[model samples]
Target chain A: MSDHKFTRRIFLSGAVVTVTALSLTGCTEPKTQLVKIEQAGAFFNPDDLTLLNDIAEIMIPRTGTPGAADAQVAAVIDAMMMTWANGATRDLFSNTLQKIELMAETLKGKPYSSLTLKQRQSLISEIDVRAFSDEVPDYAEGYKRLKDLIFRVFYSSEAANADYVPIPGQYRGNLTLDEYESLTEAYSYGG
Target chain B: MADEFDVIVVGSGVTGGWAAKEFCEKGFKTLVLERGRHLDHPDPEYTDMLAPWEAENAGLMPESFEDAGRYSMLRKKGRLYKSQWARFFVDDKEYPYSFPKDRPFMWTRGYQLGGRSITWGRQSYRWSAKDFEANAKDGNGVPWPIGYDDLAPWYDYVEAFAGISGAKDDVETLPNGDFLKPWEMSCAEQFVSDNLKKNRPDRPMVIGRCANLSEVRPIHTELGRGPCQARNMCKQGCSFGAYFCSLSSTLPAAERTGNLTIVTDAIVTSVLYDDKKGRATGVSVVDRKTKCLRKYKAKVVFLCASALGSVQVMLNSRSDARPKGIANSSGLLGCYIMDHFGGAGATGVVPGFEDRYSFGRRPTGIYMPSFRHEKADDVDFVRGYGYQGGGSTRPRTSHTGKKVGIGAAVKEHVGKALPWRMRLIMYGEMLPYIDNRASLHPVKTDDWGMPLLHIDAYGRDNEKKMLVQAAKDAEDILIAGGCINVKSSHVNPENHIELGSRTHEMGGACMGSDPKNSVLNKWCQAHDVPNLFVTDGASMSSCSTQNPSLTYMALTARATDHAAKLLKEGVL
Candidate 1:
């Protein structure tokens, strides 16, 4: 299995790099090269990529199980946008990303990527309040769609199946509710 | 040139397959006509075997297909799940329909050999004595010419062949059929069932009886099929043929008889009625692929072209004897439509039981049989509905706690989540009203120049009241069972059954004792044309809440046998 690894420095840099220098020497084929950025991953704007990585890490940081970054959620989202999503879904995602960037620029005079952890947290909290409120209809709708898509892409990834949600081999219909609950909870928690 | 055949049965769906099978098996050469293309069973185009990671859209319907207008009603019914398996069944561009501006009908349908049987929910239930006697007692719609006893033996015959897996829940209202071992329920489901039974002694919750073969019988095994893998991917068309479908079961059986001749893409335009013989001689068919018109001869003609599809053919077949439409003596031929008004129920989170876990995904749910018609005292609605529900643990959600902090709190939150529970669903009855009817489109014509069906139907006041009450009753039961966060929602009245969408769509050419009241006789033969038989949903007198496929199968079986007997006795 390919190791889906990303570093903070490599993510921040706009230039794409390979894990091994041998591929750079032209001895190996481009398709065979491991640890290269996926096509879907390439769609993420360099600045937006950094912000997404940072926010996802905050949402589901590295624990005993792999986090959102480890699941390649950004790549999934990028693929979803390019292939599956229609015009409206793509617009919704792009608009939300732009809103986050603009909000960060207004608060700190810098991109969301350049913001401190504390500054990012405060900005997100403010956005969350507005997003969750019934008064802010547009933001609420956007947030719900954004939140659902993010989770759908992340948890449904192969990474989550291996380390997070374990697929059972057989169905035993007589198991108790508590038993089902614990297993599901554990699966959700990336056990 | 009009192609000739010994027998031509319109619509290669559930009823069509049965009629074809019976005729073929009896050593009579038969030609099966279908409006749609052929879909091979076992290796059908859409099978949900692909993993989530492998899927292009991860089960979200593509907007392009939705925009094509063929799936207008289908999109609302959760049929638009965008996956690898979606392409085979969902084709919105080729098949389309137009509804009234004020009344929108979601005609959720697929035109193929197996028809909607390829993607049916497979919940099988028997109609009791009450369902058979409903129209007779109520006097609302035409009374069923035949009673439960006439269909009982046929039900056993079909069940034995189809391999219905269910437990015999000895309820008088819901008669038990020939069943295989019932599929097991989850621990949470068992607890809820036990508590509900003990508390509410009137209502009994039994395991859902489905057409899926839990354990393969010798008959099924002889046909080269095996037991179900418990994958719960039935909507994609089971590759193993563990579930019953026209492609997987009847069509194959007919093929083995060597008397069945299936001609795909042959759209039946009208039944050629012989005025002198006072019978349908054959059918005029148009090749959907080649745009060529042809005629076929047959001793007996069966119109199993769905409910509305059959009605369309009947209404299109104009003769001097019947000017309004074929066998339109009563004018009740295209009236009194009925469907199970679905999407009424309450869901809630279970309070306890955190220790139990289940293994594989069981395909079926627990069914709460009808408690309304136990002893008919005054209820708001005339007919009652049954609840088909089950309990399940909550799956993962994508809510990130403390949105902007890359810390241990986020890690901790993702590590220890709790499992929540919810109910399956309930479907109530929509009373058969004369006003709720299907008629030929005034201006619209299909791709083949056949008149399109203009279905303007809705649930009546009684149906709305039944749904409202049923929703409340479901909520009360869940709350009484110590459930939290109980929420109830009613599906839009316009959305229920899509008018002719359920594929269980019944009663356009209903059966009655008198020729002035119904289109087909008790034997499913048209009253005006002796040799013409309408054995599909159009022959149903009333629409019971139970999945109507099994009943259609039984009725078709009985009708074919009766037709054969009548033919041999020189009655025609």
Candidate 2:
């Protein structure tokens, strides 16, 4: 469920304060809080985390709101890979990363990590277009899965600040955008 | 005296909860035996409060962690099985049952203090007069000893206490109950309902009557229950007591009476019978974890374990006088098994109403009571089916089968909500066939040293034809309401829908007039054994195309009254 009271810009800015508070000594964690940001992204090595982080940022770049990087979607992915993914899924992701590196080397004469932001963006755009196109080859399939996962993880994250109501006491069958927005704003935060 | 209770109710699920509440309220010392681990009210294991991202893997369980082979059915079913809420469901590797090698039966179970009532689909509907008379009219199975009139008062009683949310829709096939205010339909749903009324008057669409408390009553409030918050995360136990469950409503009421005792991890192995006295004296139980045996004495025993659960227990309760099984003189303890056939439906997008969107996730949908209920020349099936569907607006996520480019553009695209799209899934009554039955596997036994239930139920011609008609009618209704791209799924040729998928399994120890042909009587009392009663889905002579939990609760409450009266009058 999404809570739309605070916009992504507001939530992203507020996150800086949250991070500072989290690091402060003698400040107890929230009672019901299960997972922390530090616990995530531990599955992947430094190089893989870097690649994942950059690719996630490219997939959902920061505009007027927080992007995939701010959402820490890549960290979520790493956590999932460490704990959730099976052998088959892990292999698929690993191979897909290797393929991306190979593609970067073949096209721009360097590894994907070594490329400039502009070069990486152009290469990713090419891959994204080819992956979704009707004439997509088997190689592009993994990219489609990766792209979908990135979007899914980002949207589900707290940084996305999508309109969600954990507990709206009543149901309204029909409402205008203005009415819905006001209602969500009123019943915003929940555990 | 320490091990004895006035009444022992086996299983603390939908029926068992009601039984405990009623008997305890009536001042009987009731002991509820649960085969699973104890779960407290507002269960600590609940993930209902967890945010989407806060859950591990965003609520998806890791593939490597779960057992693929043992939980093959759940693995194949996907989604719900692989969710964080899978903690509520039983592990198949531990509590295994068997069916035919070729035919798979998905017996979805939750082994906890509240049982499957913790995760029940909450849709509440009353079966009509036609449902009761179907068996006799069609000469299929035995006639129901009780009719709609017999259960109407009981239904009213349960509906008041349980707090059903439904309108008085004046539909004969679906009788209205003592209800709280019904949940509101979405704008798109209202439009479709109006259109169906104007054009297809015969097929009326009404709001789903569910167990969720739309408005809290004094009876519900007194039990510490509150109004539904429209969170829709009910599968994970609700702490607010907004939705009706054993842990939320009935069990707490039972506990307040101070006449109720509960024993967790006590698997009821059999009902101890006294042949000379012609009474069920007590229950034999095995400790789930330690495998230690114990017996609890009771004046009366209510087998409110699920339909199959009761059937398995009854079939295994063999004695010298009743060599086949206790209270099984009819030799039909595990016969005429029935579950709703489903998985055939239509989905389409409504053209307009883009600007209108509903606030709060209402934990209900629209229900179309079966128009094919009566005998008609047009229809080839015996019983009928109902459609549970709803209209909703969503952004073009992965669920919508749309392809969008990456980056800012895709993010923007997903932000804007799409027009309301509608989908309908049908639940048709599976005709009670004698051959489609449950029996003990000759040799196989579980770790508890109880016989493994071998389910052999499958859909026949009636179910197949009904599902096919259901799909056609669903598409026709959507088309009439001006929906586009109406696509209907076809029934599988091999096995119609997987048996027990709908989770409304009913009919094994069926109630009928003749004791020679049935296990129980009109009052759900065992004919051969007076003090033993089955008030669960097991006593149903006919499985109607409605959610059966409400009926089971009503029956348990009514039967408890009858049993209590008899106990006081020294009838037993």
Query: DockQ values for all predictions?
Result: 0.26, 0.35
For every model shown, what is its TM-score relative to the native structure? 0.86, 0.92
Ignoring the other chain, what TM-score does chain B have in each prediction? 0.93, 0.97
Taking the tens digit of each residue's C-alpha lDDT, what string does model 2 give over B110-130? 788888888888999999999
Q: TM-score of model 1 relative to the true fold?
A: 0.86
TM-score of chain A of 1: 0.61
Top of the candidates by DockQ: 2
For lDDT, the strongest prediction is 2
RMSD of each: 6.5, 6.1
Candidates in order have lDDT scores of: 0.71, 0.81
Checking candidate 2 for backbone clashes, the offending pairs are: A2-A163, A2-A164, A3-A164
Binned by DockQ into CAPRI classes (incorrect, acceptable, medium, high), candidate 2 is acceptable
Stretches of candidate 1 off by over 4 Å are: A1-60, A112-130, A133-144, A163-170, A176-191, B66-70, B79-81, B88-93, B319-321, B348-351, B374-378, B392-424, B479-503, B569-572
